[model samples]
Target: MSITLSHQDKITLHTAAHGAVSLMVAADATGRPHRAATDGSIALGSATGLVGHVLAEKIKDINLDGKSVAELADHVLPALTAAMSLLKQQAPAEAANFRSTVIVAIEAAARTHQAQPRPTVTDMIRKITAALDAA
Candidate 1:
């Protein structure tokens, strides 16, 4: 059976990353509610935020093992160009956010599934992220 990420799952995952980033930014901006943890954990925001940070970090290794800039540029530019051309024809802000949310959800699901062998998610986010970056 094919595995998939649900909408709720995506929101939770993205919220983690987005929330952590926001908290870090907030802390830096406001400079309050800060405490040094005795335990070895980076204080960002909530568990979801932490998970996002960790996931983002883990993906760096995968990125290192994947395609080079030039190769990815060649592979992704055409599709991006075409897609952007289409997106530009219509208002794409909401659509873009939806796309991003879906992507993050897919990533979270993949991460969960990939923790075991016979990975069901199969690293969909990494591939998508790489392509998006290249594009």
Candidate 2:
């Protein structure tokens, strides 16, 4: 079945991706460095923790509109990679952490997106008819 995203849904996805990347950049700017014997050196910040969580949750709800997992990954990978690159320049340790976190989050979102039930043709027709009748 063919699937489509409303303009608003497209905007939401775009905004969410941008916001997540922006947050990561902000985190890199503000993150604190720590040196530990066991853990070595790492950077930590609220923004760092928040970026992955927010992106994962926001991306999870995005309407893939019948796209395959690969398609979804293709769509999001660029943004994630760009963010990773930015983080790498500012904070190498944090970049590594962000890379792993983003990968896991994206994979989880892909699974969640795939698991969601798609609207059947009949469901679509009914909704369209209801809208027409209301109008």
Best by lDDT: 2
Candidate 1 overall lDDT versus native: 0.32
Off by over 4 Å in 1: 1-85, 114-123
Put down candidate 2 lDDT per residue, 1-135, tens digits, no spaces.
222334444334333243333222222222221111111111112224434343344344443331443344344444444445444554555556655543333222222223432333223223322322221
TM-score of each predicted structure versus truth: 0.27, 0.30
**TM-score quality measure for candidate 2:** 0.30
- Report clashes for each candidate as comma-separated counts: 1, 0
Worst 10 residues of 2 by lDDT: 33-42
Query: What's the lDDT of the predicted structure labeled candidate 2?
Result: 0.34
All candidates: CA RMSD in angstroms?
Answer: 16.3, 19.3
- Alpha-carbon deviation at 102 in model 1, angstroms: 2.9
Please state the error at residue 82 of candidate 2 in Å: 1.4
**Tens-digit lDDT track for model 1 on 11-122?**
3333333332222222222222232111102322223322333334422211111144334334333333333333333434423543354344433333222234122123
